[model samples]
Target: MTESAFINITELTREFKNKTALEQITLSIQEGELFGLVGPDGAGKTTLLRILAGLLQITAGQVVAAGYDLNKEPEEIKPHIGYMAQEFSLYEKLSVVENLMFFADLYNVDVKEQEDRIQKLLSFAGLTEFKNRRAAHLSGGMQKKLALATTLLHEPPLLLLDEPTTGVDPISRREFWNILTDLHLNGTTIIVSTPYMDEADRCSRVGLMYQGELVICDSPVNIRNLLDGDLVKITTSDWQEAHTVLAPLAGVKEIQTYGEALHILVDSGKTRLPQLTRALKEHNLAVDEARTASPRMEEAFISLIRKMDQVN
Candidate 1:
């Protein structure tokens, strides 16, 4: 482990009776970094987060979080990390402030400071107005904010959030991330698992998990650069026929359909642009737009997964 690594894992593996959830995974995260974990479902994102939160036992390997060895001192590590689950456990009958008070007592927040801390968190989470409302009456977004607020009452330095914004509305998701940004700026180390590529783009660094393995780990810029070819956006009158015509062409790596448009991954956009245009014309297909486009996180992720699938 590096001197500055706040979390480190080596040859980590987890298994159920019939399957391996994580396999030989190794990673290191520094203090105050916002690290995003992204992957398809059943890719072990939740298992990893659960392990970090001291909720699950590691079947193998070393994990050190917040200066405590998870294997040797799981209980000791619990107090220093704030963990939020995908389906957060909230007391349905409890009011917003009541829920916060419940968790404050559970986390053993200082008696004298609890009131001040709860008040601050209620405002920070935009729930001050709804403090007296029952948890069952809150909006989905409001409930998520309440869950996050409860997690923050103790103000742990590290947070393990499992898909915190998964089912939230776009506006609420944005608001939640803004709160996370403020916390990050205040020097908290956050590890969040999200399925949204745009959310992954906002992280300081991202780890792409696939079939229980960490396939790629890097800054968003670097991960996007991993796309082996350029992207050419082509819009056609009949995208169905255009797709068939472009499938067999040389230099074309992959063809992704987007309603009426097709994003073609080619060896070189300059070389394939005219070739694609000419071929479509020969097939009597009308082209409305054709241009080289930048590769985005979605395309890069799909391309990388395709390659991995092919190899496997």
Candidate 2:
């Protein structure tokens, strides 16, 4: 591992009974960097995070966090890292302020420093006005923020968040990301996992996990660049005929219908679009509109998964 890396995992593997959860995963997360783990459900993201937090034992390989071996020095690692699970895990009946105080006491924070930390966290989470509100009475987004505040109360160097914005509204998700950005700016190393591809773009680096294995690890731009060929969106009067005509085309690799439009990936560029249109016209398919479409991160993710499946 490089000196700058705060978390290092080498050939890490984990299993529950006869089922493997993580498979020979290796990665390095830099100090003060915001890294994201992107995967579908049952992709082993939570398993990896639990192993790094020392909450779960690894079946093989090694994990090092903040200069301590995860298996050997969990106590040493615990004080330096904070973990927030998918479920906020806040006490439902406790007010936001009380919840924060409870965790501060659990982390053994000094009484003198606790008040200032709690105040700052409340302000940062936009919960200052709701400090006296019971967690059970708060909205889903507010509850999530309160949970984040509790996790951050002890001022850990590293924060591990699992689907922090999963059920949050768009505005609340934006606010939550802003808080994370602020934490990163203050030199906190953050590792977050989400099933949403758009959320992965928020990280400095991303690891794409599938079926307990990391299939791709790179910056979002680099991952999108891995997608080859050109994509075209075709909208026509006769959708079925257009799809049938395009599916058997010479250069077309894939065709997927999205609502009223068909997204076609071809080996060539706009030149192929004209030929496609011409072919559709010959088949009595009334073309309404056809244009080139940019390859998005979601498309890249799907392509990567398909490629991995082919290899397996």
TM-score list, all predictions: 0.96, 0.94
The lDDT, on a scale of 0 to 1, for candidate 1 is 0.94
Give per-residue CA lDDT, model 2, range 230-276, as digits (tens): 88889999788789888998889877777778888888767899999
For model 1, how does the per-residue alpha-carbon lDDT over 150-233 read when each residue is reduced to its tens digit?
989999999999999988999999999999999999999999999999999999999999999999999999999998889999
Q: What is the C-alpha RMSD of each candidate to the true structure, in Å?
A: 1.4, 1.8
Best TM-score among the predictions, by candidate number: 1
* lDDT, candidates in the order shown: 0.94, 0.89
What value does the lDDT take at residue 38 in candidate 1?
A: 96
lDDT score of model 2?
A: 0.89
